[model samples]
Target: MAHYLPTIGFGEWVTTVGEVVHFTGYERPLDTLKLADPRDVKLGHLLGTADMIAQMADRCYLEKCRDRLYPEFVLGGVALPLSANGDRAIKYASGLDLLRQTPEFMMETRKKRLDQTFNQAYRYIEPLFDGTNPYLDAIERSLDFLKQVLRSESWRLLRRNPQVFAAQPDSMTNVRGLMVGYFKKVWSPD
Candidate 1:
């Protein structure tokens, strides 16, 4: 019976932690992630951590590039009255009002960052697996699937009209089914 950290809401958990500590202002998580006795840390924990990182990268790819951050960028910026640390609102961009990048460009930039982040995180834990790392393969497959999704008509439609959910409820069902079915096919063992 291998124990693994539950990955559900893992991205939001990380985001909350960052917000609480004012991004890059804390090191406790890094310092305390591993047990004092290295041997006491199970392989499952290492794998789970890497998997969670990959999932986080995926979430960031969507949120930062497609769904949230990009839209905020286009609309001036996030509407937070104060910074995460409760100080004045941080000007995250230079001449934010003058910036005009397309969603496609944002997605490409974010996908590159996602690749770097995921690869580095997974590389740290790869040595423990002795060359048979199914998680890495799964992550690659997921990236490929995401690429396909980005080119899909459903995704384009949603991007064009973020309010599609309210306008046509069945569209959500189609998107959900597409995601679920593609993941099942790619992840299932042959």
Candidate 2:
């Protein structure tokens, strides 16, 4: 959930980035859950490792959203909010409306903005891992793949069948494998 916010539009967080970041436990530590008691060390380690793996899976799902789901929604005419509503504002335009209004510049600008936002959001979750964050690694890999998709002549195929593109080598299966492999290495029931 927190990882997804990085890909969110600026309009979505104009006034609430702090709240969103805080609510996502951006600065919090999982170490707080570690028990001081000696007997519970093993259990605590297992639980913490499990939580980390879960976060990694969450990151993989977010990548899937960026690579596959978002295009579906946009092409499908799924309405999305373009900006935060003000107290005095009676109505607001959808993202599609904004695009339709200014197709020439909006698409490129929007993509840049979304990419920047995603990077900023990634920074928030980064410190939680102290340089060992699997979720951040997953997002970086997805972003690299996304860059390739945008650069090549294959974007149309991606738009037509995202599921296929999503299933490629660095897709969810590999992400899962990374998480599972990490878990196996870090946690052992001795």
Candidate 3:
């Protein structure tokens, strides 16, 4: 039986069936456990690479950056204390709320988080490709694309109403799909 773990970023479900693991909820199926050589070191690296790309691509990052993270920084036990009944005081609000409250601060916070998370990964992963790996080049391009998007007015609009752009495809997510395809391509029986 496959027991489903709590949904993580991007509504993905991590399921464990005995010793096998599955990733569901992606537009494309990710059956990493069924690789020809399950113990391959490259497999782990590829998965990590894909995961980092997916995280940056996720729309929820904006929401999390504001609703969860910003509050933790701005609100406190004394400034915005918990309820008298001990209930959580910081109720979850939309990204627009954060933007409306402090647009400049929110933009700075998002940029900082992106630098800390995505840029750090890029620095670590860049050398592994040695300038020849197409996957690595693709990742770098995607990272550049994301950085450009972050500076755009569209990103602010995205934060305000993600649903408006829901129908449109995300380039980062496409890059993740490309990474997965490359992983399969590089997986050899030898």
lDDT of 1 by residue, 1-190 (tens): 0122125535534533333332121234434443444433333234434445454345234322454443343244242235668654533332222122333333443354324322333456567788555555654554554556555634542333343434666755554455456445534776
All candidates' lDDT scores? 0.41, 0.40, 0.42
Cα RMSD for candidate 2?
A: 18.9
Order the candidates by TM-score, highest first.
1, 3, 2
- For 77-183, candidate 3 gives per-residue lDDT tens digits of 32233588964454334334443344344344235432432233334555666745454344455445445555564565334334323454674355445544543
TM-scores for the candidates? 0.28, 0.26, 0.26
lDDT of 3 at 159: 49
Ranking by lDDT: 3, 1, 2
Those runs of model 2 whose alpha carbons end farther than 4 Å from true positions after fitting are: 1-63, 66-131, 156-190
Give the distance in Å from residue 154's predicted Cα in candidate 3 to where it truly belongs. Answer: 8.7
Better of 1 and 2 by lDDT: 1
Off by over 4 Å in 1: 1-28, 42-47, 50-132, 151-190
